[model samples]
Target: MTPLLDLPSNREEAWRWADLGGIAAAAALAPVAAPEAEFLDLPGAKLLFVDGVLDATRSDLGPVTLGAVDPGEHPLGRRASQGWTLRLATDAVAEPVQVVHVATGAENHLAAAIALADDAAAQVIETYVGAGWSNRLARITLGKAARLMRSVRLLQAAGFTSLREEATLGEGASLVTTVLGAGDAGTRIDGAICLAGEGGYAEFGGALLTRDAQRQECAVRVRHAAPNGQSHQLWRAVAADRSVASLAAAVEVARDAQKTDGEQSLRGLLLQRTATVNLKPELEIFADDVKCAHGATVGELDARALFYMQSRGIPKARAQALLTRAFVADAMERIGDETVRAAFVADADAWLERALQSPSRSREGLGEGSR
Candidate 1:
């Protein structure tokens, strides 16, 4: 039997800004049946999990090794035993792999571990949905010279969700992660990546849209423990209707990690008077020969640009949507996969449409403070 760990509360520094109390309350709700899988047609293999149980018939996994068993870690890893297991071997998968998590009115706990063999390369897409609380943990390891690209999309409409990911990179290995999130009552994501071997590289970026009292937060930490490691992180958030969005990141370069290069940027857009956003980007460098930079900004739309568009005969609603889409595209355009990028942008467009429904705020008297 799997045992639950002592869940961390808001008192912890890592979870200080999260809505842990609301998440716990939602998790205690009565359990309901799992929802049917909502398919996304793509040129890739599929792995389906409903309510923490893997569905073999719907899963068309390829050469990758997959099963459900003990992850051999702690309480969170133990959840993998109750959910799905995926491992990559020698071959480079031609198509991306899709993993879907669907839930209903219950607390769903899921875990996934991806281990890449030497010289292997693969693409993976993960999607989460439904109206139930979820706790998901993923741990990954990259062998020498391996490459992995992962994309995540969260459209949980309403519920409490927490996602935690930890990864270690090997010599010359590379890992890229892109995320798109929206439509959740409360969401928290924590990510940690370690450049454990020399010449490793990691890139992390995401775009989020929140509205109508939703609370969304993402915190990521990247550590360089070896020489010649490199990493870059970029994130954008748009909030409206009393919603709150936050992005926090910490980059650390060890004393021995000479020649490390790291960069981080975070930006937020406020579409309503009551909307709020918080951004924190930090860099800790003990190495003398390293280049690291970090910055953050929060503001509203450009009134001048909006007025020019309006003067050009573009409808106010359409102009707002177009500008909002372009704001998020700054980060979304970094995605390598065209299909995944387009899908994420489409979701962002949907969000912008909803955001435009709110009454437009006047720029008068507010000055620079209006934003």
Candidate 2:
């Protein structure tokens, strides 16, 4: 049988390290009714979508306008057949807007388009919950001098999930993104941000935690299309048990993008012998005057530090959790909003607690047991 969508495979460089074949097979099954899940308690203008369908009764709409958006020619548009659209029409929105995508069934599609008017400023949060096969897409466009902060959280129980995001920044605009991903089964996310106008700036930070047999990947491409553009990307991942995590970040500077400044850094921590972590950082600069830097590193926890803490009367599990939490806290701190940052930090702490319950005992190398 022909699949509804032509999913990419290892042949494609973008998906070379991900297990897209398994995800595609799982997505072929019919969707079952989704189970009930608790929603995040946040005070703001919020919108909720259940199984790709909007739930108007539970939503609080204010100055922001909500409508239906056609995915059009987007690569994953077809998959988001029933996603929602959001627009920031006002010059400045004091209260943040939150969007929640909940799935209680299989084969669900989610998509959204966000547009910011000129000189506008807004904060947006996206929360994904429940378990199922999902293909999600988000498109963002920023007008001149606009400022936007986007935060995405994926706390799915267990299922196959894929998300793709594209953003374009106008002159002097600023865009910041913070992501917290925890998927039980498998998850993959790809994003691209283009500095289409001069003096545009972009900053992206992400933290992910995977346990058991979860397979996760995050890939991003940042393009400097105009002169004096700037971009920075930082990603950290923690993989335990037999899980796998991969991070790929690329920055491209065009010939006309002189004086461009771009930097990318990816760091991963392996928690077990059976776990795997892959980090690939690439930089292509066509302009000689541009400044760019990219680097990736993967290693196990510092055993000496862990031993020092343990010798200081800390339990083994507690010591491990403390060290692991510090590893990923830098990304969480990058979130600008005080409330949002607190929420994400709390979630990370909870994940660390759960991981410490079944701490990794393998100490094959990487200075483990050297003390």
Report every candidate's CA lDDT: 0.79, 0.78
Angstrom error of the Cα, residue 353, model 1: value is 1.3
How many residue pairs collide in each prediction? Answer: 0, 1
Model 1 spans with C-alpha error above 4 angstroms? 1-6, 30-36, 64-80, 359-370
On the 0 to 100 scale, the lDDT of residue 265 in model 2 is 85
Residue lDDT tens for model 2, 240-268: 87888899999999999999999998999
Model 2 lDDT on a 0 to 1 scale? 0.78
**On a 0 to 100 scale, what is the lDDT of residue 342 in model 1?**
79
Most accurate candidate by TM-score: 2
TM-score of each: 0.91, 0.92
Return the TM-score for candidate 2, rounded to 2 decimals: 0.92
